[model samples]
Target chain A: MSEPISGKSLHGHLDTMVLAVLDKSEAHGFEVWKRLEAQAKGGLKLKEGSLYPALYRLETAGLLTARKEEDDSSRRGPRRRIYKITRKGKRRLDQGRQEWQHFVSVVECVIGAPA
Target chain B: MQDLRVHVEKAVRPVVADQGTKLRMREELYSHLLEVFEEERATGDDEAAAILRANDRLGDPAALTAELQATASRVSWYEGAIDRIVHRQDETEIGHACRLASRYLLAIVPLIIVVVPTVWIIQTLIGSTQKSFLDLVSDSLWFGVPFGVFATAQVFFFTIIAHRMLRQFDKPSWRPRSIGGVFGLCAVSTVFLLVSSFALFSILTGNPRATYELMMPKWLIASSLMPFVMTGFVLARRREIERLEPWSSLEIADET
Candidate 1:
């Protein structure tokens, strides 16, 4: 597990992270969460419950579309709903990525990278 | 699994009153937790241990509910409160009635506060002609018109509010749609009829002088029926609400 990011730090970045996860392919809540955790090396400290709201908010904002998908794998369970990035979502993602890059540059300039 | 479901329901109920969102949330959470449990069990964890582990990972209920509510489209306080009261699963008919009455009563509080004094001041300026203060209030058609208009307007406003609140924030399947206007009309009518009958009987049997004064002239009585007509209007509006697209299957594909 990677070191968990503080809740304060995670606040604004969650939507960006969620959209980036969906940038690869459509995935349900669990798949998106697993990929996020893996990417963060378990340092993300993202709560399962909190993750859902981010997905929902993004979906509500028209940045993503969600549809019910039947669970077809051997591990039988209730149907899972997958979220796919909409055209709007992609545009927002690009905006979000640019904003993040500018933010990182400013912070790095201020604090200076590890000597 | 049962524990997970109970946790999810408790966490989600207050925040997501809409049936479609609630059901989808519950299913999604349950499926996620079950997967966690299964993965734990595969790693030589016992069933109880897996369940315990999965439950812990679900997070704080209050925080989660708040997070979800914050992110979703905002529902106003009255809308959410009225929605919960009307659509609650265990509420009985009596309970529902009381909740609705209290809610409507609260909505009318400002009008009552304003109207009573305004009427009193108007009467004071005009100078009291009747024997008692109560008689002054009871005998005047001028006071009655304002009271009736304001009160009827309040009823109309609240009826639309109730309909809009339910239609926008709650799913039809959670509470019976028929509860809105028809049931309210029947209840109001029953009370109105009983009181009017009692008053009519009292006037006929008890006092001839009182009969002439309190029975009201035919024209006034006809005008007084405006509230009932407004009630019919509210009922028709509720029927219109019934035809609104169910929030269950529909998705907002775009902001436009």
Candidate 2:
């Protein structure tokens, strides 16, 4: 099996990716993890510890808000917390996406790849 | 839940400041670990195996804790100063007391470097008897005692004010009143430190009269008042801190 993307490579984009995942749909911590893995096609394995801190930092920065709700689907466990992207989060995501695209375009151009 | 909590507690290790923050972080991390354990169990791992695997995947707890500390807003300056004094995160009460004593002594080094020369320049320019407002109050043996007593009271009040103030970041309903009480204590402590140091320097330089005139009152007041005043303040505030911190955990009172 291929090694997961190292945290060093993902560190810069973690906040943006978290915002993107939440932007698609509100998710609890685990749900967000699952979607991130799927989005990365199983290559973007995240350290479980780092992910929640990022979510918390984003929440503290006013880019996200969280609410706890009963997990009706599960019989016996704790309530699930759902985190949603705020308007500020959407704006940040747009900026991050633009930056990422620009960076990729510049790198690809240097490598003589098709646009 | 118990296992997950124990794992997290072991990882975070001696969490100081903001009980509410620590508890909330633990619960959120616990829920995430439980989800990971469930996924591992789905793959036919036993309960123990699932837990082990999940814990491994979470990365180092120490690293996670450092990151969390970095992300959290700074503790109030009063709390920061008090932490230096008391070494609040240390394991034993004796350790805390010793750390407090050592830190106060260390404060003298800074006084010698910064305060002494400034005082010398001011005194040379103004005259021998020239006194700042702090000097006049500190000069009286009678006033010095009450001033020390008042400063001691102010420290107690300011600590509460600082802790509750930081608690406001988490609690929108709680608003802090004037922080000048704490700043006032800081100012008093600074003057007290410098005057004491300057007098000590004078006595060592064969100027014992200056010691009698300036340092005696401070020593008499501070040495006599500080211990009782600090003890009383701690004892007095110990019971009432709970009502003050809405967001703090129930266990914080015991810890304090």
Over the stretch B210-254, how does candidate 2's per-residue lDDT look in tens digits?
766767677656545543443455445443453333223223222
Measured with C-alpha atoms, the lDDT of residue B86 in candidate 1 is: 57
Which digits, one per residue and each the tens of the lDDT, describe model 1 over residues B1-256?
5666666666666674444466667677778888887878898988888888877787877777788677545444454556665554456544555555555555565565576567777767788633454554455534444444444544544454444334432344434455555456544544454445445445445664565466546435654564456455555555334533232223322211
What are the runs in model 1 whose C-alpha is more than 4 Å off? Answer: A71-77, A113-115, B75-79, B86-89, B93-256
Clashing pairs in 1: A2-A41, A2-A43, A3-A43, A4-A43
Q: Which pairs of residues collide in candidate 2? A: none
**Best candidate, DockQ:** 2
Q: Per-residue alpha-carbon lDDT of model 1 for A18-104, expressed as tens digits?
A: 999999999999899899989887687666878898998899899999998974887655678899999999999999999999999
